[model samples]
Target: MLPGPADTPPGPRLEAAVAAVAAPDVVFALSRDGQRTVRCGGTAPPPPVPRERLRYELGSASKAFTGLLLAELTRSGRLSGGEPAAALLDPRRRTDREPITLAHLITHTSGLPGLPRDFFRRALPAWHTNPYARYADERVVDAFLAYRQRRRPGTHWHYSNFGVAVLGHALAAATGVSWEELLTRHVLLPLHLDGVAPHPGPAGTDATGHRRDGTTPTPALDAGGFQAAGAVRGTPEDLLAFVEAHVRPSPTPLAAALHAVRRPVLRRGLGHRHVHTMGWFQHPTAYGPLYFHCGATLGQQAFLGFCPGTGTALVAACTRRFRARDTFVATAYGLLAEP
Candidate 1:
């Protein structure tokens, strides 16, 4: 699987650790200070693209970008984070309790369910391949309007794809553009993530996603109703470029928003384990504050993390989805946690 011109990743543990994963291959990207490295590990056949340039589904990791967009829009005064999300929704349901705000949507404090209304009816039919392919835009808006919040907005931290998806929709509704267009205009272009998109791109440029067994290939997922929550496919090179901006001073337009996303926004859940920024999860490591997020499709997985104090950013991706065990997230976090 070591088939690219990319530099070998540093650390005594990284090479052996990433290479040992059982999937078709894992591309591990790392950057510390200003140095960068990308490495590929596995026995399966390599793709035509360079390891650093090969695209993998970012899944939920796309939320960090959504969070950045939220910050950038707020900073630009183009959109108000404190404004009610219902204002942008199609149905604009009247809630008697505290209304859900755009801030609540990005922070996952909007008391919405993880999946949309009647999701099981669609998901049950294609659970193994692509569950989200049928949950279209109209269904998503209907779900939001149908929601009844027993708990007030911002009272709890629930990771809701539905909530973030609505955030994407609301931003677009306010700006008179599509969610993909908003993300491209604000985040992707500013970071120079040239080929990254919310939907699938050209087929040959992407690594085929496979199930854990490494034999069954799964269909590429559409963000469909969850565009802001997931639905991005990108290369390790671009991903490292994206995470680096969080730890390194950037000349990009998103600099302030990048800094804004680093602040801890909320902590809720059992034992107070769920600490978060607008998009990324914040964990207090012995080294410093580490912000990270992981994403998964039916057949692929991705992870992104950065430690501001250590000046470290990392991305790890696998071509196959695991049923139970996941080595990428914890392993990448450990490498970044080490000085």
Candidate 2:
């Protein structure tokens, strides 16, 4: 019953933006003045739907949802960011690894590797396919337990997919719910994001992902236990709604939780001022600090960012995945830099 691209007419400004990026099947959404404008470019597949309705793998952008869930749990007094995450998991799962706090996981300072030690071993066979396809929850936990600390916990700002995935699992253990259910109940439902899915394939039309060639079907990341790391699938509209909440939070049930997530907690340098909040990276810009995150699957690239000074939030998604995928992120930063 949702409207497709034909029903939602796009303007020339959006057309120009997509063309400027040269991204195939690009969806762009901007929020300003309590209003939202969404549009898309490039070719779509059968049973055409509006680009706003086209869903793509969110990749690590899913980490923000996990971070929000942590904030919500904190707001409700269910958990504290300072607690040792190892204590929350089953004793058998705990190891001699240096203790990491929930805060470390949220800020990517847990000193865990970006991927599990065993990740490459398992992923190599399916390197071109879905690398995270069959990783089980138990295995994910075991990998965390076996991982040696690369540095003392909280001493470095290393981005670790393994750390976030462990955080998701620890929260699940604390809440007795799956990460997907926790996300839905704590974040998605409260935000009214009906278009977001727990995994790549779901009901309704999903935008077909592409390779650098712009034609090959990119494999969807059917991550299991690693789902927390990067498995969410959603449309640009849904992502815009999420960023809007960050830009201009209302007195919604999650206002306090949202505020908690955006609080600047860790600075990256002695005087550089680059910062990291719960799930967003704060970059110094002419328009003040821009809080943003970018995600990538095998074939899709997504960028979501918001500028507090301008009250503007933007989302850019490309159906094709390539080395230049970061170009979309650069494009988003440029858009924020606009006066």
Candidate 3:
């Protein structure tokens, strides 16, 4: 079994950091020096939320997993990274303009729009109970078939949930297995992460995602439609373990692929640089570079990030959406700072 923080105590500096961010029910784990680790916080005491029960909606963090899967397939020669995405769709569905390749999808450089307009206006309300709960594979295919190229495929980067969704379809078509199955076989199982489950909550082990406000619970997203886009949920420790595995140097093909995924790709927004390797945002900090991502769905706000340089990972999740006065990246760094 992987020894956690209990095996190695944290220093005073780290403990103070945890106390500072203790308000929002934050759960954090760090493995500086790659082996010695420390963890703090919980929804409650005496095992506040068991790693199994503390399910957090990872938001776009799922994109990193998707990118890793794609990279692994490409490295193993099962799929071609350079193949145009149009090849995966029916010819009748092909959009005009430059071709989109798997690389473009991984890098968010395909120039596709953030999401189809219909998704927000039409599909969103009905599925609003679960946002993406009702989106089916058939609708995904139809959307791809009907989509028009909004910009050239490789010239510029644009973050598009729709593009990643299409890539998920392409992977499914290539592997002859559903994306959920692929993730289970390749990621969850290998990482010994039993807590990670596909969207809509796996049978017998998952928590409902609630809005920040006290409104009704949002319906879980259908993993089939979101696929590798934004569907998995798990506890912060499970997420930390996953990060630890990536931080370690290994010769396995998957390990190498994960390393590749952390490569910086483009600039996302203020103080945030995008990583196409695994769809994470890289934020440079005083300690080192922090690889992080945040998600917001109605009333929920979630953030997960770690610095490979420092072996520090911070995860924060809230039932209600909370806007930050300063960038979360800065806030996190400030918390982890040596006092």
The lDDT values for all models are 0.82, 0.77, 0.62
CA-RMSD of model 2: 4.9
List all candidate RMSDs to the true structure: 3.7, 4.9, 5.1
TM-score of each: 0.93, 0.90, 0.79
For residues 111-211, write the lDDT of model 1, one tens digit per residue. 89888768989877878877887788878877887787867898877789999998888888888989899889999988899868788778677878888
Which candidate has the highest TM-score of all?
A: 1
Off by over 4 Å in 2: 1-13, 43-47, 92-98, 201-204, 324-326
Q: Which numbered prediction scores highest in lDDT against the true structure? A: 1
Local distance difference test, candidate 3? 0.62
User: Which sequence of candidate numbers ranks them by TM-score, best first?
Assistant: 1, 2, 3
Question: lDDT: which is higher, 1 or 3?
Answer: 1
Better of 2 and 3 by lDDT: 2
